[model samples]
Structure formats: C-alpha cells, structure tokens
Target: MKKINPHTGILVALAVIACWFASLFFLLNWHFNWSNPLVYLMVFVQMHLYTGLFITAHDAMHGTISPNKKANNFIGYLVVFLYAGFFYNRLYAKHHQHHHHVHTEKDPDFAPHGFWKWYFSFMLNYVTIIQLVIMAIAYNLLKIWVDEKNLLLFWVLPSLLSTFQLFYFGTYLPHKGEHDNEYHSTTLQKNHFIAFITCYFFGYHLEHHQKPGMPWWQLYKVKE
Candidate 1:
C-alpha cells in the first residue's frame, strides 16, 4: 500500500472534529417542530457527523492522522472524549488487539453470534463506567442551559444511533460470516457514495484490514 500524506489525515480529522461540534451546537440550540420533515433530516445528519468522529479517532489509532505520535494520540483522545466520553487509550489498545487477532475469540470487536449478541459483546468491551458517568454528568449540566428535547433528539439519540450505523457497517457485516481471505473480512460492492454514507468507507472492510494504515477518506483509493 502506498503511504498517504500525513497532513491529509490531519486535515480530515480536524475537519470532522469541527463538524461534529458545530452540528451539535446548532442542533442543541435550534427551535424544533417535530411535524417538519427537516427536523428528522437534521437527526440523521447529526448521526453521520457522530460517526465521522469515531472514524477520525479510528484513523488516529492507526497512526494515519499524524506522523508524530503525540499529535496523533491527542486527536484520538479529543475525538473519543467528544464523541461519548470514551477513553482513548482503552480504545487504542483494544483496536490494535482487534487488528492482530482479526475475527478470532481474542478480537474484542468480534462475536460468533447474531447481530444483537455481537453488538452486546462489542459494547461490553468498549463502554466503561467512567464513560457513563461522564456522559451523565455532561447531559445534566448541558440540559440546565440547553433544551432537554434538543439534547435528547440531537445530541443523545444521534450518538446512540451512530453506534448502530457503525456497528452494522463496520463490524457485523464484514466479520459476520466465514471469510476465506487472509483478512477474514468482506467488502461492500464498489460504490463510494454508499460506502461513505454507510460507515465512512469502512464497508470496504477488507481493504481497511489489508492496509490498516489507510485513513477513512482514503479507503476508497484502496478499493480502486
């Protein structure tokens, strides 16, 4: 695999971080009309931005976000913290374990059962008590100033929904069935638009596992 310019990854990561916060701020302050379709549209839009946060952090974990280790890890920590108060070092360790172990029992990202079962196992490995406490504290504090409904609909729900979007596209589909390939993962049919919307081009799962150093934005290049 060809090495991507490290600055490209840095720019994308920063852009994603900016977008996530901007969208969250806008939605949290927006006046709502549940009857309007646009209100619903904003929900999914925010959801995708949430997924982008994780993808940016995921790239940082791979050292794709910056050549400097400290810079890369800082971005990773910031995004995960913003996303859901997740611990970056815990995620970083587990993610590398997933890569090394692939679809085996040792892989924290994998499970042998169906979608729900696998999702539970996956969440158990990543979600922590500290994360819950942080989120709970943030929610209560933010709601004192922000609209509770907006926080629930835009901030809270979107983050939860984004988890399913990511798990379905990035984990369950790719690693569910038996794979004969070396990566033990599968790819979606080549459609970059669908790929991006689905999980930031992570539906190209084999390409990702094959070239672990590639950033989310450049995964389509690996496909080509």
Candidate 2:
C-alpha cells in the first residue's frame, strides 16, 4: 500500500494538535455561563478531536501515515501520547493482536461476557504505566497555569468521553458478537456518514481486517 505523502500527513496531524491546543486555550480563557448547552457541545467537539488523534496514531500503527517506519512510529507516538497519554508501542502491540486474533478468546479487545464487562476489559488493556505518569505530570504542570475546572472540562473530561466513543463505535459495535468469517468481524453501517462520524471508518471492521494496509479515508470505498 502506498502511504500518504509524509509532509502532507505530518502537516495535517500537526494542524489537528494545534487546533486542539487553541480550543483548550479558548475554553480556558473565556468564562461561559455554566447552564448553557453550547459549552457541553463544545466539549463533545473536543472529544472528537481526541478521537481523531487516536485515529491518526492508528494509521501510523498500520504504517499508512508515512512510508518511513521511523517517521510513522514517531508521529504515532506523539499524537497518541498527547491524547490523554499512552505508550505508543503498547497500543501498537495490542492493536496488532486484535487484528491477528480478532474475535477469538486471545483477542485483547474481546470479552466473552456483556457490554460493561467487555468495555472494562478493553479499557484495562489500553491503560499503560507511561500514561499514568504523563497524566500526573500534566496535572501538576497545568495546576500552576490552567484552572482546574477548565482542565477537567476541556481536557480530561473529553479524553474520558472519547474512550467510550472509541470503544463503543470503534470496537464493541463492529466486533461484539460471534462470527464465522476468518476475521470474525462485521461491517456495521452502510452509511458512510455514520461510519466516519462514529469512529473514522473503524465501524467497517471486516474491511479493515481484510485490507489493514489501507488508510482510514480509503476504507469507505471497500466493498463486501
């Protein structure tokens, strides 16, 4: 698979991070009426930014973001770690495991039980020690400069919300149940809009498993 132009891809990734930083700054500086609904809406928008950061890292994991392996891993590490903190190597390993084993018992994304338990299992494996350390450092650093309410509402809270969004739309919905196929995954919505809006085409689990080399933007063209 041909990777995206390294310059373009890196620029786009940097633009997103810049936008997120700007949004956080604006939210921190501007005091809003607590009872207003727009503030909450803005938070969800920020949540999607977090999810986009994850998806960006995910592309790098598949080696689709850059032709150069070093650049790919570097971009993946930066974006993913910036998304509420994570060790990029751990994420790469676990995600590769899901693609290899998929719906089987060996799959890290799978839990044989109900949604709550499965989600718990998914999250347990996702968290890493480096993430905790980064979070602590970020909290301490931000305490000196940013308001606690702004930090929680604009940064920490969106990250937590994005976990559910990614887990539900990306993992649980598409690969939750039993499957007979080789990959043991399913295509979710035929609606391209929903697919992108949900999890950046991650809902197309079977397509992704079949053509793991393809980037997120191209997955919508995949056919059953």
Off by over 4 Å in 1: 1-3
The Cα local distance difference test for each model comes to: 0.92, 0.84
Lowest lDDT 10-mer window, candidate 1? 1-10
Q: Write the per-residue lDDT of candidate 1 for residues 115-142, one digit (tens) a residue.
A: 8999999999999998999999999999
Candidate 2 clashes: the total is 0
Per-residue lDDT of candidate 2, residues 105-199 (tens digit): 77999888788998999999888677789899999898798888888898889999999999998888878778878987888868898888888
- Best candidate according to TM-score: 1
- Report RMSD (Å) for each prediction in the order shown: 1.1, 2.1
Question: For model 2, which pairs clash?
Answer: none
lDDT of 1 at 114: 86
